[model samples]
Target: FTVVNRNVVFMKELVNKTINLAKLNSDKIPFNIETISLTDEIKNSVVNNQVLFEENDIVVENHVIDEIYVEADHILLQELLNNLITNAVKYSLEEGGSISIDAVQKTGSSDIIVSISDTGIGMESSQIKQAFNEFYKADDSRHNLDSSGLGLNICKRIVEKHGGKIWVESPGKNQGSTFYFTLKKVKKEPLKQKETSISSI
Candidate 1:
């Protein structure tokens, strides 16, 4: 009875917070999205045939920075990113696995994709959907965890709100998961309107 009551309260809080975010109505905008750079790549690990990387520290992959920018709520973007990373850390193994972030341009489209992947305890099918529910918890659909069960939902809203899409996929339970969000590429210049004469003079 007590646990159920607490879950109810958590759900309410999430709804309220989401509503506020709607009022503020500021989108996340990112600039300087490079592709030819890995901000956090290993330098002294490769020798003959081996790769070594460290965990716990944020790794920035170096690659050719793509020429594309997105307009969004900066703060919301951070919140969404932080939420995913936090979840990854919260459910990660004691030894830790890996948290990777990458950005690339999608072919045949003017959009950029930012992906965050983690090697942590993956969710079951039931838990997967509940992860975004206002009060959907693994056990009770609501708990006293740091999240208000609105993190992913907020992320989904933010992405779609910005004319983008967000989704999640995993191998299965205890495997791992990757969360990806996309931002439409802004054309540097738009074509100008043409004036047509009734007849060519």
Candidate 2:
């Protein structure tokens, strides 16, 4: 039986995925947060978009904010982004739909927000509210697959572990959706390990 964490049964499993991805990508990519272009990466990847989005479409845009960088686990970030993009690609239409990613610094807050917006099948308010629950799949089409229905929850745990929050938004059914999250900006300083001292009880 899998160990369950409070509020999220998939927490431990998600961490495992992140760690595994980190080990796999350590030699090829970064493990800390850095400014990146979503379009550049996805457009260059082997994964094909199930939906063909039109040129100049505002499916998703990785807007830059004066090169702002957020504190994040890079390798894990890749996995999270990979899962989200893959899901978007799978759920989107086969033509004239696009997904864009945007990163921006939150005003009056020392955090960076990343949003992935897509033009595809939108979930209702109820579905949107419960989408992040583990093993919760609203649509049978998405449920009847070789999935654990834990991607969003996994993403949520990873984000929280990295001092961030994840959430989704949708206007209503058939309306496009956006998944957004925030990451705290970590200062560039070495973390000091605590020195253990013996104490008399």
Candidate 3:
């Protein structure tokens, strides 16, 4: 039963990845942009993946400030976070490690750089360059068949769709890695405009 269930899950993920890739290629994915609290989004992602964290005995620290705001599609942003966090968990140390999320806004730029840092099996320079390529698996021997090798590619497309950029840096093998992405930062949450009805004017 367990094996069958696992296979079923894998198949579902494969289908989802394929569909997402096709949509991304065709530019069909619709994004509903709105003001978002960066910190709250990170917290929500952590909560959504609580089970994964507990299972792996991994510690996740979110240090993003509450004042950070951005315009994004909430669902897509969550998906981006989930992919990065899951990748971190997948490459984490055998005895468990930590993943920290933080954000910094440059002095005069409207962009905020958000980073997901993990104390996991890090990547080399070459691997980092190809990490986002579709079906380009890093260290195949270390990865299970469950990996679709499309997560990072999807993440890249998502970031680009949001007019942002994504990249990764590592301190060599078994050291650690940090994935950074830029988002247009808003000074504050935009005030919601109220809807009004004019009856039979």
CA lDDT of each prediction against the hidden true structure: 0.54, 0.58, 0.82
Residue-level error in angstroms, candidate 2, position 145: 8.2
How far in Å is the alpha carbon of 81 misplaced in model 1? 2.1
Which model scores highest in lDDT?
3
Q: lDDT tens digits, residues 1-201, model 3?
A: 478997898889979988877776663345577788888988888898888787787899999756788888777788899899888888887778899999998689899999999998899999999999998877652223367888899899888878899999999999999999999997685845333221110
Arrange candidates, best TM-score first.
3, 2, 1
- Model 1: lowest-lDDT 10 consecutive positions: 40-49
Question: How well does model 1 score by local distance difference test?
Answer: 0.54
Off by over 4 Å in 2: 1-60, 94-96, 140-147, 186-201
lDDT of 1 by residue, 104-177 (tens): 87999877777777776677776776666554433322112335656676667656655678877777766877
Q: Per-residue error at 91 for model 3, in Å?
A: 1.0
| Candidate 2 steric clashes | 8
Clashes in each model (backbone N, CA, C under 3 Å)? 23, 8, 0
Query: How far is 140's C-alpha from truth in model 2 (Å)?
Result: 4.7
Q: What are the per-residue Cα lDDT tens digits for candidate 2 across 67-180? A: 444445555566677767655544554453667777776899988787887776778988988987766765542311123466676677667656678888878665668888
